[model samples]
Target chain A: EPEVTQTPSHQVTQMGQEVILRCVPISNHLYFYWYRQILGQKVEFLVSFYNNEISEKSEIFDDQFSVERPDGSNFTLKIRSTKLEDSAMYFCASTPDEKLFFGSGTQLSVL
Target chain B: GIQVEQSPPDLILQEGANSTLRCNFSDSVNNLQWFHQNPWGQLINLFYIPSGTKQNGRLSATTVATERYSLLYISSSQTTDSGVYFCAVASDSWGKLQFGAGTQVVVTP
Candidate 1:
């Protein structure tokens, strides 16, 4: 089956450093999203992208975070000046319809 | 924002037993999906039943949109079925999913 793919299954970064997570969504899917799951916590929605523009974003998706399609196949999420609390599993998803397919996820740990 | 609540936060079942997990949402939804997050933290898509019923293998799901609830049924469960099952929904005619805390299922062989 076609699936969304995320890079660097695990990443360790220093606090205050910049980090970028990349994802390749399934081809032909127009809607994309980024979600986060803090350790032992529920998954939280961060942002949704469509038509190369942000459709909606949660408060957790603040100025420190940004998303870009960058090209035809790559979708990337950047966290500027990471904080220790930013340590979590970030998931990328895409959908052609109601069912959103998720990547395995990238585990980000900020020290 | 809609609220999602899942029942029986944790369950332990004998192998081959059948089980049902429930999810309740606060409002009408245009999207409802079931996901299985394994011990390795991989979120695997299970079903997308915003309404009606759908089945795949030993797993099946039913979403009653008018009632604002959905149910996932796992039959002949196996140890491989052990994981956190999440029920996520998106209202507002958008695709941003809001997730419930999830139901942790452990099927012992």
Candidate 2:
């Protein structure tokens, strides 16, 4: 079956440094999303993208974060300056409608 | 924002036993899905039952949208079924999912 794929299975960065997490959603899906899960916490939605633009975002998706569909197949999340609290497992998902396919996730650790 | 609550936060089952996991939501939803997060942290899609019932192998799910609750049933459980089961719902006009804390199930032989 076709699946969403993410890069940098694990990443470690210093606070105040910039980081980019990447994903390639299923080819036919039109909606893409970013979600984060702090250790032992429920997964939280960050943002949703459709039609090459952000459709909606949560309060946690503040100025420090941004998402882009830089190419036909690549969707990326960039954190301008990482913070210790930003450490979490970030998941990328895509959907044609109600059923979503999530990537294996990128574990981000900030020191 | 919608509130999601999952019951039996943790469960332990012996092989060949049966189990049922429940999820309750605070509001009406356009999307409701169940996922299993494996030991390696890979989220695997299990069921997308917004309403009614569906089954796959030893797993089955039923969603009563009007009641705002869903149930996932695992029959003759196996060690491989051990993991975290998450229930997510999308309410309001948009499709952003609100997730429950999840139920950690450990099946032993």
Candidate 3:
């Protein structure tokens, strides 16, 4: 099965430093998404991307956050100046149709 | 925005037992899916039943889109089936999927 691959299974950063999470979605998939889950909380939608642009974003995705399909395969989420509350398990997903295929996720920890 | 409600926040079952999990949404949905998040936090896609029924091994799912509900049935449960089951929906305005709090299940031998 084709899978979405996220780099750096775990990351730790200082509260004020910048952090970028990278993902390589399935080759044939048309839609890509980023979601997060705070410890013990529900998974929350962050943003969706298609046609090399952002299709939609949630309130949690504010000015500090940005997503890019920098290359044909690499989709990335950059957080300018991370905050303690930004710590969570971030998931990258892709879909050829309506069914979603999720990655193992990257655990972001801000000190 | 649509509200998703999953029944019985917690469930426990013994091996060889069968169980059913329910997901109810506040509005009509074009897309609905059920995911199993293991203790390690990996979200496994179990089923994408927007409507009708589909069976995969010991698991099966049915979605009555008109009734705004979906049910996941697990037969002959095992320890490997222990995890948190989440139901999510994709609404019109937001193409991004929104997830419910999830139902935690603990299957023991």
Highest DockQ model number = 1
lDDT of 1 by residue, B1-109 (tens): 8999999899999999999999999999988999999999999999988899999999999999999999999999999999999999987546689999999999998
Better of 1 and 2 by lDDT: 2
Task: List native contact recovery per candidate, as a fraction of 1.
Answer: 0.81, 0.69, 0.81
Mind giving the per-residue lDDT tens digits that candidate 2 earns over A1-111?
A: 899999999999999999999999999999999999999999999999999999999999999999999899999999999999999999999988779899999999999
- Candidate 3 accuracy as TM-score: 0.98
DockQ of each: 0.79, 0.70, 0.70
The DockQ assigned to candidate 1 is 0.79
Chain A of model 2 scored by TM-score: 0.99
lDDT (tens digit, per residue) of candidate 2 on B39-103: 99989999988899999999999999999999999999999999999999997434899999999
Query: How does model 3 do on interface RMSD, in angstroms?
Result: 2.2
Compared with the true structure, what per-residue lDDT tens digits does model 1 show for residues A1-111?
899999989999999999999999999998999999999999999999999999999999999999998899999999999999999999999988767889999999999
The residue ranges of model 3 lying beyond 4 angstroms of the native Cα positions read B92-94
What TM-score does model 2 achieve against the real structure? 0.98
Better of 2 and 3 by TM-score: 2
At residue B43, what lDDT does model 1 achieve?
Answer: 93
